[model samples]
Target: MAETSLEQIRSRVDADWNRIVELLKSKIALRSVSAEGITGDHMKRSAQFVADELRKVGVDAKVVQSANPDGTPGAWEVIGSRIVAPGAPTVLLYAHHDVQPVPDPTAWNTDPFVGTEIDGRLYGRGSADDGGGIAIHSGALAALGDELNVNVKVFIEGEEEMGSPSFIPFIEAHRDEFKSDVIIVADSGNWSADIPSLTTSLRGNTCVDVHVKVLDHPVHSGQYGGPILDANTIAAMLISSLYDANGDLAVPGIESQEPVGGLQRDLDESTVRADAGVIDSYTLAGTGSLAARMWTKPSLTVIGFDAHPVEGSFNVISPETTFRLSLRTAPGQRPEQAQEALAGFLESHAPFGAQVRVDRLENGMGWAMDPNAVATKDALEAMREAFGIEPINKGEGGSIPFIPELQRLFPDAQVLVTGPEDPKANAHSPNESISLSGLRHNVETEALLLAKLGR
Candidate 1:
């Protein structure tokens, strides 16, 4: 892994980088929105695109269909190839091909599905969030020249954006086929454009839908304004009590810890407020350090509120109201415990005379990786060789949902989170973009990683 040798290989890759960019752009052009109204044909095309690319690179790749009848119509594909060299460690590369719903193409400067390159940056709906990573993985394997020491398995799910509902089952059923020594997730981003990162932890998530019923029907506000029990008011109070004035979670029995590793960068309050379109500059909720509050602390958010609106102006006391609550639990916290704690809080704190019902929507455990694993060390070495920078250890506030499942299924496997995304990529937002430099760094690092593991 001499620096000169690495540079020569990287320069060769740079010469043909435009073709790689074109491949990524073509993949992004397919709208594989998994959330709603996503047809099976969309996933088929996406999977086929990946399979074709893998095959073109001389990898023995095929689309393994793991469709769920009760779930989405699409199937999860695992495309991979093993190196012929003796004693090469098997590495499983994971990424998702699905994109979130593009609600407003009008809000974007270019077509959401059309990948655009301007000023050396690739812009599209899925470019940075995941498509960039997928492209980098494919290009890295291609750069490896088809023969290496380590076996590589690339698993791309078509439903990660939709919570990966079918992924765990697919893995459970096909555990033997996808066995590996290490699993690398190239989905998260670096802290910033110049900063490299490795995600060591992911927060768990639990969603609960609550319904409050006070009366059978809406009553005239003019007639029953004072005496009528307003379900809306009760629901609002209950929601308010979800957190205290200090922004600490009001739910009891939920554990919180101080997060280690990295500090969350502070954004200008004005920037946050402007992005949220808040007229008033209100202090953000939650206590303690931002990373601790977000990554290591439990949080309750009111995701949706279903009630009568002021526009309708039927000054009526609503009889029934329903709302959705999402809670982010710290790493190592059980989702079931968090769910129970939240349910208990809502049940015990509900306003008097209001019947409350709590229904759990989904629950998933958090994941924490052992950062000192051999694969992790090898990745760090490869990254330092490729980028001349040390990778930062960070924790994502979001949940992967399937990570814990993977760990359970492969207890001895090393898990690594590496990707091409940078902080400014603006994933899942308007004008989403990926840096060509970051993509190049990722390709080189991945190539070095394969080489190092092969040794």
Candidate 2:
């Protein structure tokens, strides 16, 4: 095998830029949001589209069916393979095809399902989250073509946004097809537009619904204001107690670990404010370095509250209220332990002797990767060459549950968590976008990585 020039790889990706964008736009138009009770033709279509695109680049591809416990078809997973060099290490490229629902269409600058390019960015609900990821894989493989020296396996999942309910089963059913020595999980984020990053760790996650009841029914506030306690008030108080004045999670039994150390590029207050859409006057919560709090500590968020809307407010005390609590457990903490600790804390501290019920929703463990692995070293060098800057070693605050599962399945394999998402790419939200230039650079980086690992 000969040394592949970086210029040749860049030129190949640049030549196929239009085809890549067109492929992404076709996927974005599918509306394959895998929400609960939502299964349909679009999901299969999206998965098939991925397979067909890979086939166009001289790869063998197909859409595999995701199944239920009873062996019923649920969703689809696309798998593609290109074996250029026999006996070479197989690299599995992973991403997802399904996206999140557009909760509010009015908040978007363009149709959430229509991929739009503006100001050197591509905007759509899944544009950056994973549609860009799919393009990156396809473009990288296309760039290498027959010159690729490794056996490549591409796995695109279908239910990532819905927490991958059938992911483990799907993988278990097809374990042989997923065999690989290295996996590049292309569903994470970059530090910024120009700054590449290798995600070093991810936080565990759990959710529980807290229900409180203070009375049998609503009562007139005017007549019982002084004597009665409203369910909404008590629920709000209990939720508030989960965090201290400094914004730290006040729950006990959860554990924390040392943050991943390497790049000192701490997300500043201004960047946080802008990226999170926080008001200027509001102060950031928690303690320690922002990186530490984000990646190494437990954090709780109120996802939703089941209470009466302010629009139809009357002078009455509500009987019951329920709130959904989303907790991000620290890297070392167990989800079951965190769930128990949170539920117990809420039950023991019930305000004014109110009846409390906590229902656990979901749980996922965190993951950490060795920084000195051969594939990791190759990826870092490839990224530096592609982006012309040292890639930052960072950890994501969000959870990618299947990453740990991959590690457990192949303990000796190296897992590289890398993606093209930046701060402005509002994935899982309206008006999501990805930098076009950034996507090109990331594709080239992946191509170089595959070349190096093949050697």
Candidate 3:
């Protein structure tokens, strides 16, 4: 039997679906990619936009800004709204307004920055990855307003895609203002389009840049081919050694425990290969379930490799070669510890007479949610009501750098991660799109969740 409040909210969501989509489309047109070409002026405008939207919903909203101690051009701003209710739990709604770079504009069917609708899908760079979540959260709050009993705090950041570097420091400075009983991170995705999900774990990340110097200068191939050592060859060998023949990461200390549940093996290998754009000459290595390799295990990828180009093949011994290493560690593993292990391995295992330098890059610890938490249970129930199916528990392969920080600051606070995105959303890739059905269900589920939490 449907609860009276839930049925009303669901009906409201259905009635307002078109308007919600229009609002989302407007938000997506901003092209708010936070990495490069993002100015302080643009951030201020975007933050103000969010605050203004919240204000229209009758929530007390404002844009609070703080500058770095070292005089930098940019300032950190948090768009916040608070809903007051007597003796009720305070929940913080967190989402980011920023997005990743939209490269290769020609590859997209529509302008990457201009939101466009095609066959029941909304296509835009940030549509599914985050804009859809933000839209759903905004729409839910707009529809419910002060009718909900719980106190709500909404804080949307502008630098999440850039590793949220400024958010933690700002939060630390204003710890008292951001305190809450629960924090809903509406940034992750469902397992599939139809199967609603809650992300229980996120893998930690460690990046290292390795530079090898084998010669002082490039020399002619015929003159130095046999005698001279190639830096490119040495760099490739180092990268190859990081993975074994079975395609398992050779890095020690990082755990590789398999996930308990199984994955969707119904997906064809051809589809996976096509989506990944894998060359026909090669095949995906490693064994066991794809989810295990993706989420519960350690994986190493050579993200960037630089050397002399083959087009101008002088065939000379290269003077220098560099490669970037990205190590994804399982939950319960510390990123800094993994980075140290990786550095030690690279330093001690470099080939003879080759000067290798390993520089630490960005690192963040992983997060694992308590499955038995009351909020998790409530979220599952709410999802079931909205989707007519039980939500799946899964681990995300990517790292949300600030999640562990939030856990540290608010140890007692319950965290729930759910959103309208799906695997084929093409986040961080060209032609990103969001399913319209996903957006509607997320909005309805969140509204129902508010009523459920109050009860």
Task: Give lDDT tens digits, candidate 2, residues 1-455.
Answer: 88577899999998999998898888889888888333577888888888999898777999878886667676788887887766899999999988889889999999888999999999888898899899889899889988888898888998888788778888887887788999999998788878898898899999999999999988999999877878989998888888889988887787766676543677677787888889878878888888888887888889999988989789999999999999988876778898899999999999889999999888999888788899989988998999999988788889999999988887777999998799899988879999998999999999999899988
- Model 3: pairs clashing at backbone N, Cα or C within 3 Å: none
What does candidate 1's lDDT look like per residue over 204-306, in tens digits? 9999999999888778878888776788789988888877789798778787866645454533456546645657847777777765765678877888998
Off by over 4 Å in 1: 1-5, 36-39, 69-76, 260-280
Model 2 stretches astray by more than 4 angstroms: 36-38
- Write down the TM-score of every candidate: 0.92, 0.96, 0.94
Across residues 39-100, which tens digit of lDDT does each residue of candidate 3 receive? Answer: 46666777777677767666677877654435343444555656566578888888877777
lDDT of each: 0.78, 0.87, 0.78
Residue pairs with colliding backbones in model 1 are none
